[model samples]
Target: MKITTIGLGYIGLPTSIMFATSNHQVLGVDANANVIDTLNNGYIHIEEEGLQKLYNNALKAQNFKASLTPDYSDAFIIAVPTPNNDDAQKSCDLSYVKSAVRSILPYLQAGNLVIIESTIAPRTTEDVISPMIEATGFTIGEDIYLAHCPERVLPGNIAYELVHNPRIIGGVTEACTKAVKELYLTLVKGELIESSASEAELSKLMENTFRDVNIALANELAKIGTDLNINALKVIEMANRHPRVNLHAPGPGVGGHCLAVDPYFVAAASPHLSPLIQTARKINTSMPAFVVNSVERLMASAPNKKITVFGLTYKGNIDDTRESPAKEISLMLQHAGFDVTEYDPHANKNEIMIEQACEDSSLLLVLTDHSEFTTIPETATDRMSRAHILDTKMIVKNCGDNVKLLNLGNMHQSLNKIVQEV
Candidate 1:
């Protein structure tokens, strides 16, 4: 089967390559000419585990090609971005998704399956996409099958999760669901659960919102623990020992496109009914300031205000920095009159090396839990004015006796020590 996937981004590129390598002809369409040119030359613009090699194999099979425009194919997958609006409600913006669908309208044929893999607001398939396609003189379920299949994969392990994760396919009609299911069965090893399009849309948003709320609880616990002279991480470790209680770890703040943004979509859909979600978002969003205050407290114990940040990506071992807390923390620190330098080994062309960033710095702030951050270079610590570290993600290790470690669990102790000295 010939497939056309629009928006050759993190998800679209991998899905296109998977289909191409699986013996289906694929045409990847992106608005960026640079991305198209890069892929045509057998180079991917994004980094994922084992994607480059798979892309090369797909190129060798002569099954996949990328272009600036769409082509006629048996299936069309719209995997474009759905960013949040600038309004107070922060609703999901469907401009890119709508544009991608409109681009394929001219090439769409009867019996062609259209799949929306982008995360969207509920009833988008029925209200927005159906009306658009119906205007083109084709019945949605009868002429062109439509389904909402949101992407559920991690960044570092996207290539593996894309194939192994359980998938949800919600269609306009029952026939539409089955038609799209056959295409996914080629690659998805996990169970394919079918439902209405609205169900799938809400399911995806809730999955991320659930994590956001739980993380907010953990962050709240951290604040309370600090007030009562207790360790939040230790509390979580003990609480999670119960068979049914599973708590998420608190960090500087929630980041990435999904967890930090999806809850707002739900809140926008129904402002009054989603107070818990709204409150959770408020808590998570305020974390950067909390971290900034923590930095100031840590700095009180240090000899100087020069601070070096370890990681910037939303999570560990990836190049994506969309809505990263590290960026927010760095900005807040600078605005508060502290000289800050960030260093991430996984980041593309980091501004400075670890040793250089640590030069004359008094505090080392570890934001993202990259494995490389587990062990700091002994030489890097030699340059610090005062060797003190704050591990927000709680993954740092292998520091000698000279370097003092501070984390969520022991921050109260550090604060108490500072008071005693005063």
Candidate 2:
């Protein structure tokens, strides 16, 4: 089957690649000419494990191509971004999604399937999108099979998860659900659960919101532990021994397109009923400031105000920095009159030379938990002028006896010792 996937972004590109490898002809459409050019030249613009090789497979099979506009196909997948609107309620902005559907209207035909894979506010498929297609002189369920099929996959392992992860197919009508399920069976090895379109939308948002709220709890625990001079990580480790207690780890802040943005979509739908989610967002958003304040306390008596930040992406091993707290913290630190050097190995053109980044720096700050950050090079630790580190991600264990190691578990103890004999 010939498939057209609009918006060749992180999700769209991968989904397109998967379809291409699954014996389906695919046309990836994006607004960016650079992305289209890159894909046409047998290259990808985003970072993901094993995506490039799979894209290579698609190119070899002669099954996939990218373009600046849509094409006539058996199925149209709208995987565009649904960013938050700048309103007081911070509702989901469907401009990109709407534009994508409109672009494919000229190519629409009877019996073709339309799938919305972007995370959206609940009822969007039934209310917002259904009307747009209906206006084009096609009944949603009868003429064009419409469904919401949200992608549930991780960044680093997206290609693997694409095949293994369970997919939720929520259609406007029961016939719509069956049509989408038959199409996606080519790629998904995991179960395909069926539901209404709005149910699928809310399910995707809630999946991320659940993580956001649990992370907020963990962040609150970190703050309480620091104030009380207790180890939050230790508490979490012990508490999680209970079968029902599965606590998340706190970070500089929540980032990425999903976790940080999806909760607002949910809360926006019903502001009064989503106090817990709103409060969780507040706690997660304030974490960058908390990290900056902790840095100020630790660096109060340092000889220099130079800090080397190890990572920038929301999580590790990806080039995505959509709403990164590292960027926010870097700005705050610079505004506060501190010299900051950022070294993101994944995003940067150069490789990670930890010793080079730490040279002449007052302290090293590890933000993301990339696998390469598990142990610092011995030379890197010796190069720090103050020989101190504050690993907010808690990925590093020991930076040797000469360098002071401060994690979320022990920042309080060192904060008390102002004149830390570095």
Candidate 3:
């Protein structure tokens, strides 16, 4: 199949490469000429595990090619960015989607399948995208096909997840769904569920919203545990043993592109309709402020303290900082009149203000559970003036009795209680 993928960023490039490597002719279209040139040379702009190998092989095989302009193809996949607007509203910002649809309309012909792999609000496929294409005098489902197939790949493990994760295909019509499903069957090993375009859009939103709400519950419980002078970490651990009760760990804040933003799309579409989802978003969004307050309290305990924040990425093992809670916390601390330094092994040195080494600091805050941060020795802690620690992800287990460890999550309370009792 000849596939034309629009917007070759994080999602587009990987998906295009996957199809190309699978022996499909893929023409990747991006507005940026440099990105197209880079891909044509078998180079990737974004960092992901094992992407370079697939890109090189696909380029060598001549199955993958990139262009600055859209062209005619059997299938048109829209994988552009659908970021929320400044009002915290979930608007599709359809400019990019519209532009892509317009650009391809001139080249679109009958029997062409148009699949949207970008994360968007429900009804976008039917109400927004389909109409834009139909304006070109091409009938959908008969002359052309339209479907919504949201991408579920993680940034660090995108290459693997692109092929491993289950996919949801929501079509304008049943035939459209089957056509998109067959195309996905070429690369995806996971099951493909079919639904209406709106249902599939809501399904992706629900998946990420569920995670945000659960993590918010953990964060809210951690605050309660802190107020009661109990360890939140150990409490969560005990709660999880109940088998039916599973809780996500609390962090500095909800970060990254999806979980932090997607819920707002649903909430924005129906404000005063989804209270729990809105509340969860509020809780997660306020976590940076919570971490800032905690840091202020720590600084108050030790006058004129120099604080070091470990990790800037949203999660462990990834260099992405698109809405990193750790980075926000660091910035908030600096704004609060405290000396703040940051260190993330995955991040470029220019991205962080502090030196890579964890020396000459009064306190260390472990925001992300990066492997390098988890394995830091007591000797490194010894180098600091004060060994006060804030383990946001609760990755560190033991750090002796002298270290003032602050953990996020209710499970930490029980563990701290046990330590104090000993």
Candidate 4:
């Protein structure tokens, strides 16, 4: 299949490369001329595990190309970002999706499969996108096929997941479903489930919402533990020893494009019935502030206000920082009048060395669970005036006894005492 995939960000670029390397001709389209230029010049803009090499393979195969505009192709995939729109409803801004679909309309031919890989709210494929495709005077299911095929791959492991993961193809019509399925047979190795477009949209949103809710529960427990002077992490560990009780760990807050944002789509679709979902968002959103307050409380007796922040990406080992609470927390600490130095080592262009970031700092704040964060260098720790570490992600195992370490696991025991002393 000759596929024209629109929008070449994290998801779009990798997906374009995936199809291009899978024995399909792929023309990746993006509004950013720089991205198009970069991709066409034998380089990719985003970071993924093996995407650069995979893209290089696609380039070698002479099947992948990039452009600023869409062209006629056997299949068209829209993989754009649907960011949050309104404050009251928290619905998605579908302007990018709409624009991408409109751009491909000029090149749509009969039997061409149109797939939306962007995660959307329920009924968007049927009610919203179907009408836009129909505007081109091509009847869906007959002249053109449409389906909502949301990508279900982790960022770091996209190449493996895209081929192995079971894909949900939500078609506007039965013919649409079957046609889209045939298009995906080029690459997908996992089972392709057929369903209506609305189900697929809701399924994708709920997949992230379910995790958001559980994570909110864990965050709430962490808050309550501080109030009651309990070790929330130990309690969760003991509870998970049971056969069915698997609780999530609490952190500074939830981030990333999915977990922190997707639940709002469900809540916006039906706000009256989504009280739990709405509340979960609030709890997770509140966590960054909770972390800031905890920081202020612990730093009451510090010699200086200088602090070092380790990691800013949403999760570890990736440079994607969309909706990152670590960044938000860093800003919050700065707003509270603290000297802050952020060092990701992996991300932030390796801006500041660990030793430089920690120089004369009173506290070291660990956000993302980067593998490199397992042990802090003795050189960096020696530079801190009063070495104290706050591991919100709970990944730091060794900082030495010279540095006082506090995490969610043992925060409660010292929280109230710290508050009293402050």
Q: Could you tell me every candidate's TM-score relative to the true structure? A: 0.98, 0.98, 0.92, 0.98
Residue-level lDDT tens digits of model 1 in 287-405: 89988987888788677889999899999988888899999999999999999988987775636677898999998999999888999877998899998889999988887679988
Candidate 3 wrong stretches, greater than 4 Å: 88-90, 349-356, 397-403, 409-422
lDDT of each: 0.92, 0.93, 0.83, 0.91
lDDT of 1: 0.92
Compose the digit string of candidate 3's lDDT tens values, residues 48-137: 789999999998899988898888899999988877776756555667887888888888989999999888887999999888888888
Model 1 regions lying over 4 Å from their true place: 420-422
Best by lDDT: 2
- Which 10-residue window of candidate 1 scores lowest in summed lDDT? 345-354
Q: Evaluate residue 382 in candidate 1 and report its C-alpha lDDT on the 0 to 100 scale.
A: 83
Candidate 3 C-alpha error for residue 286, in Å: 0.9
Which 10-residue window of candidate 3 scores lowest in summed lDDT? Answer: 349-358
Query: How far off is residue 345 in model 2, in Å?
Result: 0.6
lDDT of 4 by residue, 1-422 (tens): 89999999988988888888889999999999999899889998987898999999999999999999999899999999999996887798899999999999999999999999998888999999999989879999999999999889887899999999999999999999999998788889999999999999999999999999999999999998887888889989999999999999999999998998889989999999999999999999999999999999878888999989998999988999899999999999999999999999667774877889899999999999988999998899999999889899999988877988889878766667767775
